[model samples]
Target: MASCTRKLYHVHGFDPRQHLEHYFSDKPDMVFEEDFLIFPIENLTKTFLEGHIRGDVLIDLSLGSMIHHLYAPSEFFKNIIILKVRDRCILELKRWLNTRTGAFEWGHATQLHINIEGKSAELQDKEGKVREAAQHVAKCDLDKQNIMDPVVLPPADCIISVFLLDCICKDQDDYVRYIRKFSELLKPGGHLILIGVINMTYFTVGKDKIHGFAYDQDLARKTVAAEGFVIDKCVTKKATGISDLVDHKGVLFIASHKEK
Candidate 1:
């Protein structure tokens, strides 16, 4: 199976601005509110905040925005390194992190995080925590044998990837190939948090429909297990209804670790 070409992804898919604005809002039409933010994101925040997992370096293989980690309990990981796939995504993140103009404001997401964690008004402080933890935003090439090339990174204590596997892959085998590649960054027994839209083949952005390899929970588990990870947690966010923005019946969150 072949991976989706990078040129296609850059041209039509993974628009950093649209991705940020659409999925990180509180509105019911926003998929984040209806499915993603409530279950998968909230579960992740609560689990990490509760001290269920501990780590030093958290490697982000998610090419999307860094808003997910902004809500997480920050004390566990001393630093975060986000490995991005596209240059535009990196620029978007850097713009926001540096507080530059034209960058989309993620304060709304931070506020939503505060409400979910039941914290008192301290949105800016939490934003700082995320920024502090994120020490690097480097470009990554899943096409490479070493995703982090020329500069090898120490195996990370935790690896988190959201909504990336399917889009970059052509089929189940292609997805597993990349999964195995990224897992190399994880220390043995380190945690892996992967979130994806379930049973989705393609998604729309503006006038274009970007393609993705559709997958379900069964294949998700089997593939990770084939890589020697033991699943510890699984959470699914069922879609309330259908929409053109995304085509998925549910979202799945998986927390697992390689066998030590």
Candidate 2:
């Protein structure tokens, strides 16, 4: 089991496209669509509808090259800054942002956002708004004092991190440390939206089996509180799909704010 488990950065076989398709694509039989795409989308839309998370800038530190989670936030925030850990993930996002040939089609995600909001908007227009709102994407190193070192970033009003900690953290302490780093990127009163897996030990990206820290909701709450965050809401959805690609028991979503 130890030999099979690989750290995220060391997994050179990680395929961004395959990763997206396996978990996020609009497939008829894909079980992950509900957990990875719909669950976050619905919860995020609900949070945004409550009018508590809007701001001038929102920083996203998500796993892979996913943009599905940003659809609702794009409408509420004036600017979105994305920080990616890998150059491949950055290039994958840029392909869609620049509307280059062979970019992964996200029309399905855009349509889902529209349908959930019960609003009248064309898919192309909604996609454009999300693209426009995403003003910057840069590589990040969580180990550094400044995650985006040499490129000083202003404190954002909100930060959304999806499934990143699970992939990067090797233990409970690492999770706590990363959460503290996340808080530092936000303004004192800013919000933090986290969507991650629960009791997940590993997940597959292409042929690589990357390590995931198995954590429960209690640990998440305690970690966030210990890092100076006040939890406003916490939601969990049990895994309804059976797949060998990932061993996650459920999905966890937390909406919290840094204590001022």
Candidate 3:
């Protein structure tokens, strides 16, 4: 039921409102009932407590409020790093995350947001608004096939590469490369927790091709396992229902680091 501000940014002759309504509307039903700080479903928090990880890094690709909303207070990791493609969705997501205008700042302010969505007027506009506030926002477009780039931040104990796989990739190779970069961003024995939509029929975000990556779940699982990650859990369940904003069948992968 969260209202999104992306409806106003649509290009001419493109009314993806209905399409997007189905896209943005559906969410994890547990989202509202579970407090991320103490949520049991989060494998990262559970792994951190099991003494499997210890370090100064928690890279959050596709930086959105959901992950932070769940893990920020836990401080399970020392430093949090965020990466995202520069699009209206991410920009809106960042705005919601950065709106800590209360009397106190609860979490550490060491988090960073790297803008990796290539160049476009809409993307430029989204970045322009957030550039001043996010000190570490980077200018790289994963859609342009630059997934092998080096990590912009230091190594971390865990990398919560959630919801980014569906956004940053246009094909299998790009998806593999992006996951490699995500792994490279972490130190060995670190963890990776990823969530993405699988078996999606189609996607369109205001005249933009935002959802045509042919999300091969089996191939993706094999690829991540090949990237020195141990497959702890891969859950593919039908969401209880569809959302009016966003539409797609989805899957989740919670991966841990392999001891080399």
Candidate 4:
């Protein structure tokens, strides 16, 4: 007799519209990215303003339907290239890039960044900066040796990724392998900024649960270091455990550079 078997859940990732509605709601309390992801970016911006992280080409890796965090970097970088894995995300982002209709409200994120970094109170100016700086938005192939296959994306001087790889990568090895690919996009000594939830096994979008690789600070530190990345700094923010919107022990921010 054949045995009954249960299939494992695959993390194909979440829909951009549902994700936006759930996480980026009008109620500030419901907004997760604005609260958790923006501060680390503020710190990055402060360093850039002080002439630390320099670059003409800044590559944003697999950022799904969210462009608010790029606000601070836009002021420093000459060009910004956004790459994504899914077609739905690309369409959502393109809608905003083209005309701003049907786009998730990003003004709060902009305001948060401005409040933290004092970039500017003018919301339109901040959005305009990022919109203007985003030179290209195209699909990426993380499975390939050259992830940015078609464009031959100019070796980035700095690359930023947030809450991207963890969900898409099926296992810890997958996570580490993609980091290597992410590093390959950088020029010698180029910086890498990674932001994600610590030990997050899954996140919820609507009624569905999106699975992700589980990891901690030690794993993060060891993997990046093992890949020959010089760890510049690491930061963490404690989660309040107030909401089950996503189950994460905490949030971790990592900054490192490929050795020169």
Candidate 5:
């Protein structure tokens, strides 16, 4: 199995370290440019935002490399917000959103944040309604998106669910749950910009082994549609150097919007 995995890596010219650094770099410009798979997402997002999604809320569930884009605001979203429900890093997001101390400026309409690692908590407003929470929180699983540590805001106009599926979902059923969580956050007709690795991605994130679900462009579209979303645009591109240390081939997804 290991040899087969290695063969697969060479067949695809996968280089894990480079791929990981491309998306995790602190500097946005430092993002990996060689990989064409991610470019389509950037292009598609820019294209969709040209004039169609002005003033819509953008909720980033996975704050990995995607966080870099938040620095450069796009025209599609009226507000760009982030949610980190992981126990250890939850404070990092909270501190980022707490602009009152001049630490970091959201510049957007509002910067809402929460950390639910220690408590069995749910986000409820004054009305006692179980507001929308982090839908992709994975725990004690080798392959899942762990965001359950915090319960953030309710559903909004848009939710940007990035490579989260690779981390939080293992099968189609798990995918359904994650998608439902994201869907609940949006009002009718809300928009969603989802990005995910289209193939199995397994790598050593530090000392822990993280496994990704085998994703493809077609499956992505089907999953999105199953969640009551209309596919507005879809893109797929080739990936390079993603099988060595962090074995992930590439990313592909569609921009879906719920109809009112």
Candidate 6:
């Protein structure tokens, strides 16, 4: 039986559409909308509303092709740069940004964001703002000194990474190493916003199960502090969705600023 068991798929082999459908679709049975979508947006909106996280350029390093978390940041930041690990993820994002055919629908997420902000703007207008703010989308490699390599990026005022580390990092050392890299991308006193699953070992994307770095809030807090970040806010939500797609105990959101 052990010999016949299939190995877990790598993060690079991710199918964007299938992953999106399983976790981000509009169907009633899908439970990730609350933990993955609404939770981050709400926390981000609140953090931005407090008026401390100011920046001209914001860098986003997230998993797959997610854009829901950018709606609020687009309103605050002048420029948004998205870095993806996989080519397919980059293509998927471009399809939506360019308004190409077969792009995944994000109207629900847009509406939710607008509703939370109590704004009366049209959904299309908000989406257009996101597209305009997101001026660049490029591929990145975590193993490199310069993640973008060849094309050096100016130090951003803020960086928002959602669920990417959990999917990519193999162990605590990898997590800390990547956190240091994230520090390198920011200017002094710049902010770092991270959203990830707590104590999650694995998550399913399509037919393949992918590894998730099993970590808790304490590790995240200590790691960030060790990397010269001053913790500003940390929030966690217990898993409410009764689904077996992922064995996540809960979701975590941390907002910190790099020390000068």
Per residue, candidate 2 scores C-alpha lDDT tens digits across 153-225 of 9999999999988888888988989998999899999999999999999888766788888999999999998
Ranking by lDDT: 2, 6, 4, 1, 5, 3
Q: State the weakest 10-residue window (summed lDDT) of model 5.
A: 108-117
Select the stronger candidate by TM-score from 1 and 6.
6
Clashing pairs in 6: none
lDDT of each: 0.74, 0.88, 0.47, 0.75, 0.50, 0.88
RMSD in angstroms, all models?
Answer: 3.3, 1.8, 11.0, 3.7, 11.5, 2.1
Q: Candidate 1 lDDT (Cα, whole model)?
A: 0.74
Residues 1-260, candidate 6: write the lDDT tens digits. Answer: 13223223233457888888888778888888888888988998888878888778999999888899999888888799999888888898899999999999999999888888887889999899999999899988778888888899999999999988887888999899999999999999999999999998888776667778899999999999999999999999998765877899999999999999
TM-score-sorted candidate list, best first: 2, 6, 1, 4, 5, 3
TM-score per prediction, in order, is 0.90, 0.96, 0.60, 0.89, 0.63, 0.95
**Cα TM-score of candidate 2:** 0.96
TM accuracy, model 1: 0.90
- Model 4 C-alpha lDDT per residue in residues 1-260, reported as the tens digit of each score: 11122111222545787777676555656656534556555666665676677778999984468776687789888799998888888888878777667777777777777887764469888888888999688887788777766658798999988878767777779878988988888999999988877887777765667766788889989989998799887888776544676777777788889998
**Which pairs of residues clash in candidate 1, taking residues 3 or more apart in a chain or in different chains?**
none
After the best TM-score superposition of candidate 4, give how far the Cα of residue 129 lies from its true spot, in angstroms: 0.8
lDDT of 2: 0.88
Minimum summed lDDT over a 10-residue window in model 2 is located at 5-14
lDDT of 5 by residue, 193-233 (tens): 77666675564443344556777777778878988999988
Q: Candidate 4, clashing residue pairs?
A: none
- Superior by TM-score: candidate 5 or candidate 6: 6
The CA lDDT at 118 in model 4 is 66
Candidate 2, superposed: residue stretches over 4 Å from native: 1-3, 9-13
